[model samples]
Target: MIAKRLVIAGVGIAAVLGGTAVVLDQVTAGQSADSRSAPVAGSSPTASGSGADPGTADAATAAEAGGAATAEATGAAAKPAEGSASAPAGREVLPAVSPSPSGLPMPPPPAPLISLPLPATASAQGKIVDGFPADVIAFPEGTVVVSTGVSSAEGSLQISADAIAASSQASVVGHFQQILGPLKFWSEPVQAAEGQQSMRFSRGNDSVTLTTSTTGTGSTRFMLLANLHAAAGG
Candidate 1:
C-alpha cells in the first residue's frame, strides 16, 4: 500500500508542473505579441504598470527614462549661468557724464588807468582854480586842469590856465570857437603849424589868448591867458 500512494503522489506532482509550464509559455507568448504590436498602436507604453505585458512595461519604462532625459537637457539649455551676461532688449545704455567744476575762484580786477600831465601842481592837478571865469570859458568834458593862476593888477583881472584834454587839436579849437562866438568876441585868424595852434579873441575890454598843441598820444595840451577889465559904471 505504501508503494501505491507514492505512485499517485508522483502523478499529481507531474500534472501540477505541466500546468505551471503551460501558464509560463502563455505569458511569454502574450509578451512577445505585445512587443510586436506596441510600436503600431503607439499607446500601450504609456498605460498603467499593473496589468501591462513585461515587454510593454519595459518599453514604457525606457520611454519615460528617455523623456526625462530630454526634459533635463532642455532645462539645462534654457537656464543661464551664474554670472553670464543677459541679452539686451530695447535702447542701448551709455556711460554717465560728470559735470564740470563751477566753484573756482576768479582773478582780481585790473587797476584803473590814469594819464597825468607833467608839471602838474598839487593844488590844481585835476580841479579848476578859484576866481577863474568858469561860465565864459567852458572846459571840455573830462579836461584835466594841470595849472591855474588868478591875479589882479591895475584894477584888471588876469587869469592863466594850463590843462590837458583827451581830444584832438581841431576839436578843442572848435569848442572854444563855439563858446566865444555867441558872446560877440571877435576872433583873430588862427595861427597853425604842425599840430600847434594859437587863437586870440577880444570883446570890449576882455581879451583871451589860447595856445594848443597835440601830444604824442593824440591828446591836446592847452594854455590860456585872459585879461578882463571891469565895465564902466554910472
Candidate 2:
C-alpha cells in the first residue's frame, strides 16, 4: 500500500490524477501537508515493472506526481492566496495548475512586472511624442509617445514621450530617471542599437518603461511608458 501526501497552494487542496479526483488537505506557505491515501491494490504481480498490472502502474504514476507537487508547494517562493485561512498565519501559496472548461490545465496567473524589451526603431526625424517628457531636448523633427501595448483586462493607463534627435541610450534613460524620482529600476537598459535601448522600472504596482531608438533618417526616438493598472501589481 502507498500513502500519498501532497502540498498545494491555498484553496487548492485537490488534484486530478489518472482521471481520479484526489483531495489533499489545505497547506500554508512553507507548512507541511497531510494528504495520504493508499493506492488501489493491483492484481497479481508480474515479472517486473513492465508486467505490473494496470492498477499498480496507475498507483506508481500518481505517487511520483504527488511527490513533485509536494516539493513545489513547500518551496520558499510559494505565495499564499489572499483571504485564505492561513492569511493571518503568514502562510503563502503559489499559483497552481487550474482546470479549464475543457478539463485541460490552464496557465498560471501572470506575475506583476514593469516592462520588457524595446520595440522596433523607425525614423529618427519625426514628430515628438507628447505628454511624457523627462526633460527638454532639441530634436530636428520632434518627439512622439508610444508604448508596447501590453494586454490586460483590468484596463491600463499610458503616458509616453518620444524624441527625434541625436542622443545616447544612457542619456535618455538618465533624463527619464530624473523626472521619475523615487522610481525603482527592475532591469538595466539593454542596448539594441548604437542609439537605442530599453529598460524596466517599477514602484509598487506602477511601472515605467523607457525605450529609445534611432531612425534611418538621422533621428533619435525616445518613449516612456507609464501604466497605472500595471503599477497596481497586475
Candidate 3:
C-alpha cells in the first residue's frame, strides 16, 4: 500500500511542474511581443506609436512652403518695379521745360551792313562831280560839297559825293525820299550806326545810299553814293 501512495505523489508533482513550464513559456512570448512594439532609443514617437502621423507631416510641409513663399515675396518687394526709373540719393532734380508762347509776333531780324571802298579823287568844297546824276538824285539843299567823284566804266556809272548841310539828319534823309518817291524808288533794308541815320533807294538796276550823322557844330554831315546803269542817266 505504501508503494502505491508514493507513485501517486510522483505523478502529481510531474503534472504541476509541466503546468508551470507552460505558464513561463506564455509569459516569455508576451514580453517579446511588447518589446517588439515599443519604440527604439533616440527615435521619435507618433500618435499611433507605430509610425509617423500623416496630418503632422503635411502641416510641416505646408509651413515650409509658406515660409519660402513669404521670403520670395519679401525679396521681390525690395526690388524696383518695371518701367520705373529712380535717381540717386542726395542728387538734384532738374526742372521741366515749358514751351514757348504761340500768340505773340516776333520782331524781324536786323538787316546786314553794306561796306564801300573810298575813292582816290581830290574834290572842291562846292562843285559837283562831272558825271553826277543831278536830275535823278538831287543832293540836300544848301549842301556844301566836300568831295565828289564819278566813275563810268563796265556799262555802269557810280557817283559818290560827301557834303555838309546846316540841317538835321531827318531833313537830309527826307529831302531825298520826297524827291525819289515820285520816281518809283523803293527803300531797301539798312542798318544805321549809333547816333546816325541811313537810307537806300533802289529802282531798275539803280541804287542810292545816303548816310547822315550829327557833327559837333550841330550840323549834319552826309555821304551819298549812286550806282546807275550807264545808259539811264548822266
Candidate 4:
C-alpha cells in the first residue's frame, strides 16, 4: 500500500508539471502570435494610424497639384491682363505732333503813321504883306505841322488855311517834292462832278489835295493839303 501511495503521489507531481509546461508553451505561442500580428497591423493598408486614409492622401496630393496648375494658368492669363491694363486707352493715346515748316517767309508789316511839328522860319522871297496865324503842314507821307507865331517884319510869320487846302501851294509842292520823291503825283487836274477838283497823289496809299483861288486884284493864291493815311509802317 505504501508503494502504491508513493507512486500515486509521483504521478500527480508529473501531471502537474505537464500541465504547467503545456500552459507555458501556450503562453509563449500566444506571445509570438501577438508579436507577429503587431508588425502586420503596423504594415497593413487598413491599419494606418492617425485616422489617415490612403485614398484621402492621394486625393489631397491631386488637389494640390491641380491647384498649382490652376494657379500657374491663372498667372499666365493675368500677365496679359496686367499688361493691357497698364497700356493707354484709345482716347489717352496722343496724336502725332507735326514740326513747323522750315524756311517759310513771313509777310511784311504795315507802315506806321508819322507826326512832326516844325519850327518857324521866314519866307526869303516875300515881305510881311498879308501873314496869318499858325500853319500846319501835313506831308504826303506823314502828318507834320509847321506852326508859326504872329508876324511883323522882324517877328516870326504865321500862315493860316481852311484845313490844309488853303495853305501855300508852292511851299507844299516844294516840301513834298523834296521829302517824297518816291511818290507819284498827278500831273493833270483831277475833276470831280460839278467842276470840283479832287486832286489825288499817292506813295503807298498816301494822298494830297490842291486848290487855287483868284484874289480881288487878279492875284492868285493856291492851297495844298496831304493825307498821310498810309505812313503807318515806319
User: Which numbered prediction scores highest in lDDT against the true structure?
Assistant: 3
Worst 10 residues of 2 by lDDT: 131-140
Per-residue lDDT of model 3, residues 102-201, tens digit only: 8979554322111223233334456886546677767777888888877755566678888999999888888888998887678864898888788999
Per-residue alpha-carbon lDDT of candidate 2 for residues 148-210, written as tens digits (9 for 90 to 100): 232333434454445444655556666666655534435455555454578776655666776
TM-score of model 2 vs. true structure: 0.31
Best by TM-score: 3
True-structure RMSD, every candidate? 22.3, 42.1, 13.6, 16.3
Candidate 1 vs candidate 4: the lDDT winner is 1
By lDDT rank, best first, the candidates go 3, 1, 2, 4
What candidate 1 gets wrong by more than 4 Å, as runs, is: 1-125, 190-195, 232-234
Q: Which residue ranges in model 4 land beyond 4 Å of their true spot?
A: 1-47, 80-85, 88-234
Quantify all predictions' global Cα lDDT against the true fold.
0.75, 0.50, 0.77, 0.48
- The Cα error of candidate 3 at residue 213, in Å, is 0.2
How does each model score on TM-score?
Answer: 0.44, 0.31, 0.45, 0.26
How many residue pairs collide in each prediction? 0, 18, 0, 8
Question: How far is 141's C-alpha from truth in model 4 (Å)?
Answer: 40
Candidate 4 TM-score, true structure as reference: 0.26
Q: If both were scored by lDDT, which would come out higher, candidate 1 or candidate 2?
A: 1
